[model samples]
Target: MEDSIRRFFARYEQFFLRALAGEPDPAEVAGLYAEEFIAASPAGVKAGKNDASLIEAMRQGHAQYRAIGTRDMRVRGLRLSPIDEMHCVAHVAWRATYLRADLPETVIDFEVHYLMQQRQDGPRVFGWISGDETAVLRRHGVL
Candidate 1:
């Protein structure tokens, strides 16, 4: 079961990488999301279960990037803390670098706390809260 969660997360990481690279397959991106997945980022609330809205969001985001890149997408820290087999939080550390046509090369760090939902079948990210303590640390290369 633990292995299952790990695999799901690995797949999620790959999906992000693919999206950043501007080659996300609609089906692959769709599969990781639940029918009512909601991710609250700095941008705003994005909620969708179907493919159209999600794909549109992805497309719009891709259009904004001259080059959006990611690296060190590691599970720097993870805990099944306050352990509930069905739900847990993940502390994911990642670096995102971007170079827009209008802007200079900017490397921003991110630490996202994903309120992940685990099922008997596998794990699916249900919701998220960004900009945590680790995010500040990562922004300055402190983590």
Candidate 2:
């Protein structure tokens, strides 16, 4: 059971990284999220009642911040906690080096508590409660 869950999350992480890097492939992002997908970030919240809305929002988000490209993306770790039989909580950390046309490379490290629920269709992602420790890629030298 653990192995299956791990595989699912690993695949999802890869898809997310590709989307964040502006892959422009809707299926890459859409495949990971369930029919009722919800995402919460520091800036805003988006809920997808169906696959179409989720993909559209992802495209818009990438378009809005399309200037930056994500590099060195990795999943630091994942620990599944018991929320219930159907839902699990995952403590995860990730880091990305960002490059923008206007600004030089900057690295941001983020840790998020992901509350994940496995549904018959797929994973309904939510409960991203917090993130921390963002720093600039100083060695790269911002322009």
Off by over 4 Å in 2: 41-46, 101-104, 120-122, 132-143
Residues 37-83 of candidate 2 have per-residue lDDT tens digits of: 55576656756565677679778866654444555467777788877
Clash tally for model 2 = 0
Best by lDDT: 2
lDDT, candidate 2, equals: 0.63
Please state the error at residue 53 of candidate 2 in Å. 2.0
Clashes of 1: 0
Quantify all predictions' global Cα lDDT against the true fold: 0.62, 0.63
Residue 121 lDDT (model 2)? 59
Model 1 TM-score on a 0 to 1 scale: 0.67
TM-score of 2: 0.69
lDDT of 2 at 86: 78
Scored against the true structure, residue 71 in model 1 reaches a CA lDDT of: 33
